[model samples]
Target: MSRIAYVNGRYVAQRDACVNIEDRGYQFGDGIYEVVHLYDGRFIDADLHLARLERSVKEIRLGMPMPLASLKLVLAEVARRNRVSEGLLYMQVGRGVARRDHAFPNTPVPVSLVVTVRRVPPYPSSLDGWSMSAITHPDLRWARRDIKSVNLLPNVLARQAAREAGAGEAILFDPATSMVTEGAATSFWIVDAEGSIRIPPLGPTILPGCTRAAMLAEMAEHGMRAEERPFSLDELAKAREAFITSATSFVKPVLAVDGKPVGDGKPGPVARRLFEIFARHVKGAPRNALQ
Candidate 1:
């Protein structure tokens, strides 16, 4: 079966869906994107993802080419067209097509939109946790790091470094401040000895993750404390447990950083608890009654 994609107002085959070369997203990386995970044929956290989509558009001054309701319809249509019962939906919006120039186009340009769905392996059941590495790199992006923009050169390179280093994710640290911000593609967190779940607050340093927020609520329901603040890289290395969260990975525990064991070189209890709660919340089957 051929995969389908939605381009602008038209539904087309993925191979046939093409955008103009002058599209700002392609030309200048002037676009924002969102990735949402699906389970049991339902979006894991649709509302949060949608809210972030709106935030991204507002931050970048890029009008959502269509009303959000219409966009959701298009997204569902795209998911159905690709037969993606369990997978990811990727949607992007660009500043639209304009002549080859650096500045924004003067006249109103139609916001270019593309929605694609792809089948991903089922999210892990156990989430026994995975190990990752951190390769320090200069923070070389624009000041507004809060926006989910498409200019991901630094992240691409950093992820490559992690891959080559034989790690699952790359956690980046600010060289100047020596504070851990987040993973190349996920939000980082640490569970302290006091049983507090710590994640850096929203800033130019971290991409606010939807799963992370969901887990915060899950924490409260599961009888855990949530803290939003920054901690040192040293604190992370010495913390009780560490993990990263994203729309795709959900909640992946990080047992090591820079080839050193975090805590007992095993998935910490706090992270494991969050993972369990998250799974129960998204799985929607009343906690499985057994593990």
Candidate 2:
């Protein structure tokens, strides 16, 4: 079956969906996007994702194309049309077509909205061969990363560099401060020697991740303490275990960085337990049963 996409105000074929060439998003990357993980025919953490979507439009000075309640219906319709259970729902909202000048159009134009879904493999239930290797790269994006904008050239380059280095992801750090910010596309975290869960504090340096937030809540509910503090490269090198989280990758263990083993060079106990906890949360298992 041909994939279906919700473009602007209509449901259309994904292959034929198009935005005008002068669309601000196409010309200046003047748009925001969000990816929500679909699990077992449900949108996992959807409220969080939609909340972020609302925030992104506000940050970028674009009006929401439609009310969120209406958008939710569109999301459900698109998902049903494609019959995607385990997949990603991608939404992009852009300043609609305008004349070729850089500034916002003198007259307000309708914001563009496009939503699509595609199938992906089921989320892993175990970490038994799930360890990944990563490479460190300099964080070279603009400062307003808090907004989930489509401006991702720097991330694309960094991730491509990681792929060329035979690594699964790129852990990007601030060159001047020597502090780890996040991954090319995921949120970074570490289990320190003190057995604490540490993630970089929320700010302009990183895109706050939905999965990262959910995992932190899960940890808190289970009596686990998580510290939102930045860790330097040296600290990262000495971590007991490291992992990255995102909508698609979920909770993935990182066993090595820059070709060197982190901790025992294996998926540590903490990461394995966290993975199970998050998997249970995704499956809607009772919170008390998570421990």
Candidate 3:
């Protein structure tokens, strides 16, 4: 079956969907995007995702294409039309089409909105024996990494580098300080020797991840405290365990980094426990529970 997409306030076949060539998003990558995960036809962390979307749009100085309520309805309709029960909903808002120019168009123009949905396999029941390897790369992204912008060349390159190196992710670190920033598409976390969760503090170098926030809340609920402070590459190497969080991969364990084993070269107890806790949190809570 052909998939459907919402483009510029119209629902159309995905293949037939198109935006103007002069659209700032297409021309200069001036846009922001958000992705929400769906489980059993319900949006997981819809409120948080919407909040982040708004924040990103504001950060980029672009007007919202539609009101929040209308956007939510559009997303729901797209998901329904595509029959996406367990999948992802992606939304992109651009500065609108105008003559090819580096600066923002002088005249006011309506922001462009596009949304698409696709099915994804359910989360694994157990990462018991499964693990992912990651490679570290120099953080070469713009300073405003906090914004969820459409510009992702550096991230794309880093991810490709990881793929070529037979790894699933690339953990980016600052060249100046060697402080770990984040993954190409995921938020990084480590379990320290004292069994405490350590994550980098909010800064311009890292995007504020919704899944990372949810994981922190889950950790708190389970009586585990997370430290939000910068950890260096040396620190990560000696950490007891490590993992990454994202809208897609909830709590994935990282057994190795740069071909070196982490924590006995296996998924550790902390990561396993957190994964179970996160799974339960997502499954047991109602769609609006977080709202």
Best by lDDT: 2
- Ranking the candidates on TM-score from highest down gives 3, 2, 1
Q: Could you tell me which residue pairs clash in candidate 3? A: none
Q: What lDDT, from 0 to 1, does candidate 2 have? A: 0.91
Ranking by lDDT: 2, 3, 1
Candidates 2 and 3: which is better by lDDT?
2
Candidate 3 segments exceeding 4 Å error: 287-291
Model 2: per-residue Cα lDDT over 1-291, one tens digit each: 999999989999999998888999999999999998888878888888888999999998899999888888999889999999889999999999999898899999999999999999888869988779999999999998889999999999999999999999999999999999999999999998888889999998889899998998989898888899989999999999999999988889999999999999989988888899899888884321101
Candidate number with the higher TM-score (1 or 2) = 2
* Model 2 poorest ten-residue lDDT run: 282-291
List CA RMSD, all candidates. 3.6, 2.9, 1.3
Q: RMSD of model 2, in Å?
A: 2.9
Every candidate's lDDT: 0.81, 0.91, 0.90
